[model samples]
Target: MKKYYWTFIFLYAAFSTNAQVKYADSLLTAGYTQVAAVEYERVLFETQDPEVRNEAILKKAFCYKLLGQYNEAYQNLLRANLFDENDSINDRLRYESVLTAFMASKYNDSYNQYVQFKYYSKDTALVDQAKVIAVLALNEQQKWGLASELVSELNESYSLKLDTAELFAVSKRPKIRNLKKQQLATTFFPGYVLVREGQVTSGLLSFTLKSGIVFSTFYHIIDKLYFTALLSGGMYNVFYAGSTEHAIESIKVNNQKKITRFNEKVSNSLFKALETSNFLLF
Candidate 1:
């Protein structure tokens, strides 16, 4: 009778744990990620089975990742036992560790983790993933030369190679615009610097606005409209003083945008070359 009672308790606990896991999975599927994460934590606290605990932790990490809480996801992954003798779990944990670090903009840490994972992993697929992540991390760090070399070593497609080459070229030989020269140009002609920077629309708009203000001020002055002339002069002075600075800022922003787009293109090319869509979330 006592043995049967103990068996019943064990069975009840097992059933409860399974029910919790199923509920959490349902919540995750229903897009209640926050609730699902809490449920997973409950399962983690209640389950003694190593596999069940690991699954709960991984699912909770995924929930955090979906919520854009990469730091939380990374911390959760760190709680996983690495020497659990489960190759699949260990590989996924390492991969996610690198991924979360990268997502958090900890590029150096991501690169170092990838290096260690690559050296230790015998699995070809995991190694390939590590290589791709390492290259991406290096790119984020602005180590374009090293990233390009890794892409080459991976024997990526010709198009991807060209993309990396372009990235390297642009990174090394960027268009250097002198802010002082641009400011001087804007001082002489309100939109001259913008036009030179290929921002024709902005340049034309600036020119038209400034020209209108100046013409109105001069017209008021000539017509002896003293109050109107004073107001117009004030407007002109305000715009004239800020125009060069605005144009310089716009030029810098545009240049930075171009570099950002270049980097994105290289990153996309790298991901495409590795066919990361199968394994990667982004």
Candidate 2:
């Protein structure tokens, strides 16, 4: 009777695991992402089958990904214990893991994982995708030379031939090289320089106030050549804020506010750029 009882307990446990998996699948299919993740976690805990547990873990990761909980998704993928080096599922999981890193705005981590994924998988398409992502990651950090080198490598890769439009689209987005030339223009028109460097507000206020006040004082001495050649630069040409140099200089005594605002805009832009297909090539 005791032997029979043990057998019944084993059978019930197996049934429970199977039921849990079924329920998780149903929930996932129904778009109940968070609850599905919980059910998958339960299957991972209850199942003795390694295959079942592995599948459960992957599904849980997918659930997290669907919910936009990228860090959690990445953690779940890390918990996957695949021993087979050539396992096809490993390739998929690795890609997904890299994707989660990208979604989380962990570009450095994503770039590293993408490189490893390319090395391990040797999938030409995946490799090309990884290269573009790496370029974007470096571009985000303002590493222009490295990003440019990667772009050149991408242009040579055959895999990118099929994705020509997207390749060109992403390639053109990095403006670091242009930024260097922009810095030099600061001497000609500091306002334009600031605006071009993502310090739009500061640039506008500073250039407008300074140029306007300068004009008021030297309006009689200032010639068309000086104004047309320097002050009439592209940056000043675009934004014309109504104020005086003295007013702007008074505020500029402490530049922390402008710096903070610029940083915030840059941070927002970084996340916005990541949401594009260019970042999530997978």
- On TM-score, the candidate that comes out on top is 1
Q: lDDT per residue, candidate 1, 38-155, as tens digits?
A: 9999998998877677767777877888788988888888788766776766776787788888888888988887886777666766666667777878876667788778777665
Q: What is each predicted model's overall lDDT from 0 to 1?
A: 0.73, 0.59
For model 2, the run of ten residues with the poorest summed lDDT:
1-10
How much lDDT does candidate 1 score?
Answer: 0.73
Per-prediction TM-score: 0.59, 0.51
- Report the CA-based lDDT of candidate 2 relative to the real structure: 0.59
Candidate 1 residue spans exceeding 4 A from truth: 1-23, 26-32, 44-54, 66-72, 78-85, 103-109, 156-192, 200-241, 264-282
Alpha carbon lDDT of residue 97, candidate 2? Answer: 67
List the candidate 2 regions with Cα displacement exceeding 4 Å.
1-19, 48-50, 159-281
lDDT string for model 2 (1-282, tens) is 234323432342343346677778777667687898899899878877765676677678777766768898877887776554535556656766677777677778877877788778856666666665676665455554565566656545432223323433444333223333544455466576556446679778777665775565455336546544454444343443322232244344334454344334433443354444243333
